[model samples]
Target: MTRDRVPHILILGGGYVGMYTALGLQKKLRRGQARITVVDPRSYMTYQPFLPEASAGALEPRHVVVPLRRVLRKCDVITGRITSIAHGDKAVTIEPEAGEPYQLEYDILVVALGSIPRTLPIPGLADNGIGFKQVEEAIALRNHVLDRLDIAASTTDEDVRRRALTFVFVGGGFAGAEALGELENMAQYARRYYPQIGAKDMRWVLVDAADRILPEVGDEMGVYTVEELSKRGIEIRLKTFLESCVDGHVVLSKGKPFDADTIVWTAGVKANPVLADSDLPIDDRGRVSCAATMRVAGLDDAWAAGDNAAVPDLTDDDPDALCAPNAQHAVRQAKLLAKNIAATLNGGQPKEYRHKYVGSVASLGLYKGVAHVYGVKVKGFPAWFMHRTYHMSKMPTFNRKARVLVDWTMALLFRREVVTLGRMRMPREEFRRAATPKRSQRDGSN
Candidate 1:
């Protein structure tokens, strides 16, 4: 065996693409051929498909995320942001959590930085709306919804109670639909505990500019999804957009106005903005342009994948078709990307990536789902079962897979916990109260 100087391989993000691609390389490469380094803002990779379950308290939040250092022990992990990339010089500037920025050089570069939630210049979006991408957001949303129920139950003012119970979600894609489905189900289940609040007291409205929802599952399944959700008392406002949301007052394009305490924005995501600072060839959509082999176009020793790269969809016959930004393609692309990288290091030609779209499955809530797989359409319990089975198998590591399965098994045998720890948002409340003895003394006359 010929041993060569270690080639430093730098992965820009610790997302699904970066983490999985590094795992593949660790297994394929020899003893001392290359050194792998991963950089990201977070120390864990979230299994996004299971986020709705986490929010609904069906799965523990800890089980849905994989710790990066524990999983990638062989690689160097840095919790930092890549502020800029100078691909022409094979270097990047990183702004870590605490300290001055520094530059590092590498021989091989993998630009797997993922997408960011796309936002519009709406009136109250920045102050009121929350996103559905991270685990923390999911947990916060769960607590927020339960807290709203508590508020509604305790308050006598009709307007305050109505606003607290109303949830407005802007987007009709899988994220928005799944989030709305799981949360609505959770709220319904929780309503039984509140004697003052009933199912009729709560309202869920899903707004989307697009004419249809769940486009990934086909037109038939999409229509079925709308019908199923409508039967559950969810208002589907298609061909509508949020005109303004100033001061919690939601004004729709159809001239309907209402007040909602909660607003979730899951409309879409665009490629990470950092790509614009690099010298690499970026497409019009602000994504790094790559060939079918996952190699960056017009650049040597450079690779890109996931949502940040605009790789051609060779499986589709259409000349202008690009791969959709979904977990299915991201996971598969990581495997092929690792292979091509290893082949390049071994002085071999890289293979082009091509795969057929098998199908999609989305969970509506516990025991309810919709799936369209390989020309077969299934709904209700069967589809929900398939949803869990597919995502459980796709989870990154064996440890996570076992933990997730245990969570599900426990939910089957025991009742799901519905207690909301709203105090998580105010971690320092007790300390502040204890420190202020004068205020407590003044109010203790009762």
Candidate 2:
């Protein structure tokens, strides 16, 4: 390498860690210190915390995502997948969406590929179960739920109506609970528009293998979450597994098999398995082993964090404890990671990453929530308000923050929009139907 050549820093993902790290680096580094390049499959970074509200029509989907090219003006953004990484050669194979794979060399590599859904081999789950991770999934779930209401309202068959109105959510974690809370609230509100469907007609059930839900919040808050959902006529099933959902026939371990039209899977996530192919040191959970400094263990030029890396939890007494996979930790780690990289490039020492756990807050519905922060507990409206206030402040750009604020203000002034563009799923269906000829035309009767 020539002394005149600037160092190329490659970021593997444009998620919470990747995007924020680039944002920080672009600000912290000198004008000619390093050239930054961020590679991600999608062009935008999603604010996952706001996904539930967006799904429930309280916010727009586009507002929750920040376009990578627009935000990272100083960085070269590549919409491609990192197929393989050969750190020994300081290069990675990139697979663009429409082209053949190619190799890209860099002086430093940042792995923030994040995690994917941890799924099980339950019968019909692969065919029928829908996950609640990406914005697309959230939008699809909203459309499906509303479409079911339409079906139940129009159907005359009692069994069919019952099945159409039944919505089942598996996994009592943050995603499942929040999604269920918001969507159930939206569904209940939408019911008023349909005179045929009563409050009792629609069924909302939450199933979890563990005995508790929303464990991120506190024990008391978790219990309160269950009770609150119960008050809304939503059933909570704990210490139970989804034995099967063959053809929408939900069979639980301890209950009579019931048929549901919609099934949502929010069961945890696992680290990306591609890290192993890079020959990086990984923990048993498939996460890259990262030091307190957010650098890959035993490697100088490689860095990793977020859900894809097992970062030491310095705030914990347990030596083996790792940071929790959440937006709070990811955002903080990304900022530190950028500074650390810049410090190393400029012959300065990189600092360690450490932070004490503050607590947690979750939105149950519009004005309903639970929060446990700094040893203080708050429930209902106060908690809900805190959830919005805290996340909105943490939300990425001022542009997004203002857009989200406007969305909330408008929502308070008007009723929620209950329209479902379910056709977005299969957009070509209407076109295909319109282009197809009728039997009379086919037979030349007209």
RMSD of each: 2.4, 1.7
User: What residue runs in model 1 are displaced by over 4 Å at the alpha carbon?
Assistant: 1-5, 437-446
Best by TM-score: 2
Task: Estimate TM-scores for all models.
Answer: 0.96, 0.97
Q: Write candidate 2's Cα lDDT for 327-382 as tens digits.
A: 88998999999999999998998888998889899999999999999999999999
Please write out the lDDT profile of model 1 over residues 242-327, one tens digit for every residue: 98888889999985699999999999999999999789999999999999998999877899999999989988999778898899
lDDT of 2: 0.93
Residue pairs in collision within model 2: none
Q: Which stretches of candidate 2 lie over 4 Å from their true place?
A: 1-4, 438-446
